[model samples]
Target: MNENLRCADEARTASVVELAQELIRRPSRGGIDPYGPVLGVLEEWLDARELPHRRLRDAAGAPVGLLVEVPGGRPGPWWTLDACLDTAPYGDETAWTFPPACGDVADGRLRGRGAADSKLAAAMFCHIAADLAPRAHELAGGLAVLLDVDEHTGGFGGARAYLADPHAARPAGVMIGYPGIDEVVVGGRGLWRATITVHAPSGHSGSRSTTVGAVTRGAHLVRLLDAADLPGGDDGSGFPLPPKLTVTAFHGGQGFSATPDRVDIHVDIRTTPGFDAHAAETLVREAVTALDTALPAPLPTAVTPVAAWPPFRLAEDAQPAAALLGAAAKAGLTVRAKTAGPSNIGNLLAGEGIPATAGFGVPYEGLHGIDERAHLAELPQVYAVYQRAVLELLGR
Candidate 1:
C-alpha cells in the first residue's frame, strides 16, 4: 500500500475498533433499539464530513435504511456498499472470555459480539466513505452506503421493504461487507425456514396403538428426512448450480408423563442458484406424507413455508467482481469465489440485477458464537484492499 493509503488505514484502525465497541455496547439484538445508537453515530459522522445522505423510514417512522451518497462527476453505473446493522443476540455473557461489548483488543484480536460478524464491515464501510469523499468528484459512478436494520432475524423485512418502496435508491452494483478474509465471495446460498406440524388425537400413555401420538409421528418424519438426500455441489463454485439443504432445528413432544398431542419440526433449507422453492417444498412435503403413511393411524400433518429467501450469485466477470479481484491481487492475495451458508443482503441486490458479492472485511473465527473476534492486525491491510476496490469500481 502507498504511504498515504497506509497512513489513512492506520488512522481508521482505531476508529474501526471504537465503532465496533460502540455498536456492541448497545446490545442491538434483532430489534429497533439495538440499531438506533449506531445509526446515530453514523449519521453524526456523515454530517461532520458534509456527505449527502438520506434516512429511509418505515411506516412507523423508525429508521430502517441509512442511505449515504457520494455523487460522482459524471453519471454512470451507481455502486452501493451495504452492511447489515442488526446482530445475533449475545448469549451467556459468562461463556465469553471477555465482556460482550467491551471491544477488548488483545493478542492481535478484537473480541465482542457483532465485532466480526458484521459490525466490523459497517465500520469499515464508514471509513471507506470518509476516505473517498474528498476524491468523489474524480469518480465516474455514484457511491452509496446502505445500512440495513434487520439481518440476523432475516434481511427481507429491511431489504424487501427497501425494494418495495418506489422512492428507494437503486445502484448499479452493490458490495456487501460480509466476513471474508481477502477472498472474493461471488455467491451465497438461499435459505428457507419451514415448519412441519404433526397432529394426532390425544390418548392416555397406557394406550399403545389405540391412538397415534403426534410426537411418535414427528419422530418418524424426522428419520425419513434424515435419510433423504438434499441437493448440494462443490463448495466454491459460482452460480447457476444445484443448491444445498440441511435440517438445522427440530422440536417436538411435551413430557414423558403424557403423550404430546401436537409436534412441530423446524427446518432450515439452503438452496443453490437454480433451485426452485416450490419444488423443494414439494419434495419435503412428499417425504412427510410418506412418513405419515407408515404410522398405524395416519396423523394429520402440514408442511408450511415459514420464510423463504432466494440464493444469489454474481457473474465472475462482472465489473464489481473483477474490481474486487483486482483489489485482492493488488493487496498481494489471490481471489477465490465461494458460497456462504448464511444468507445476506447480497441476495436482494443480486436479485435486482446488481452485481453484488459478500466478503470484504478482516478475517476472524467464531462468528455468531461465543468468543467472536476479528484479527486486529489484518484490519489495516483489509481496509486498504477494500479502499482500492472501491476506487477501482468508482473509476477514481
Candidate 2:
C-alpha cells in the first residue's frame, strides 16, 4: 500500500476499533436495554469530530437511531451507509468465552455481542462520514451514515423515520454495513407475517361431548402449513431462493381440565419475487379454509396480516451494487452479489422502491449467538473497499 493509503488505513482501524469497543462495553441489547448510553457514545464521538448529526425519532417522538450526513458541493444522488447500534439479547451469557460486554480486542478479533452483527460497522461508518465531511466540497452526491438502534427489535423505526423525514434527502441507494466479507447482499426474501387464530368449542376434559380443543386444531393447522406446497424458486425470475414458511410461535390453553376456545399461531413466510406477498397470503388463507372445512369449528379461522415486505433482487449493473462490486473487484476482493434467505432492512427498502446493498464487511463468527466477534485482519481492505465505493458513487 502507498504511504497515504497505509496511514489512512492504520488510523481508521485504530479509531474504528476504539469507538467500537466503547460502544460495545456499554451494552445496548435491543428492547431489553435503554439505548441512550450506547447512542450517547457515538453522539459524543460525532460531537468531538464536529460532524453534523441528529436523533431520528419515531411517531411518538422516541429516539430510534442517529443520522449523520455529509452533503457534497454539487447535486447528485444521495447515498446511505446504515448499521444498527442495537444488538440481539445476549443468550446464555455463561456460554460466552468472553463477557458479552467485554469488547476486548484479542486474538485478532473484536469480541462482544454487537461486534460482528453491527456495532463495529456503526463505528466504521461514523468515521467514514467524518472523513468525507471535509472533502464534501470535492464530491457531487451526499453521504448519510445511519446508526439504527431499533433494528434488533424488528421495528426498523430509525429507517422508517429517515424515509419519513420531510427534511432529509431521499437516498438513491443504501448500503447496510452488516458483517460478512465474501458476499455483497444485493437482495433478500421478502416477508408476509400474520397471526392465525384457530377457534374451537371449549369444553371440560372430563365431558363425554365430542368437543375439539383449540390446541388440537392449532396442531392440525401447523401440520397443514408445513405440508403446504409452496413453489420453489423460478430460475427465470432471477430470484434464487424458494418461498419459506415457518410457524414461529403458538399461544393457547391454560388449565389441563378445560379445553381452550382459541389458539393463535404466528406464521412467518419468506417470499420471493415469483411467490410474492399476495401469493403467499392466498396460499395461507387457502390452507386455513381447508382446515376449517375438514374440522368444522364454532367460529371461523382468522388470518390477520401483520407485516408484509416485497422481495427484491438487484441486477448486477444496478447502482450502489454496481459501484460497490466494482470497487471490491478493483480492490482485489472476491465479493459476489448474494440474495439472502432471510429478509432484512433491504426488504423494507425494496417496499419503498429504493435499492440497497445489505451485507459486506469483516468476516465473523457467532453472529446473534454466543461469542459474537469480528475478525480485524481484513478491516483495512474492507474499509478501503467501502471508501472507494462511496467516493465513486459520489463522483469524487
| Clash count, candidate 1 | 2
Cα displacement (angstroms), candidate 2, residue 247, comes to 1.3
lDDT for each candidate structure = 0.75, 0.92
Span of 10 residues, lowest total lDDT, candidate 1: 231-240
Model 1 alpha-carbon drift over 4 Å, by segment: 1-9, 231-243, 273-275, 296-299
Tens digit per residue, CA lDDT, model 2, 350-394: 889999999999999999999998999998888888999999999
Give lDDT for model 2.
Answer: 0.92
Give one digit per residue, the lDDT tens place, for model 1 in 1-396. Answer: 699976865777988888777776766777635467777877887788898876777777776767777878876777878887777777787888888777777888878878887788888888788878887888887787777777777644566556666765577777788776756778777777788888877766876756768877777888877787765655354454555556666676666667777888887777765565775787788887797677744445888898776787776778788888778788787768776666766766666766678886788877888888888777877778778888878776
Clashing pairs for predicted structure model 1, backbone only:
28-34, 243-272
Task: Give Cα distance to truth, residue 26, candidate 2, Å.
Answer: 1.4
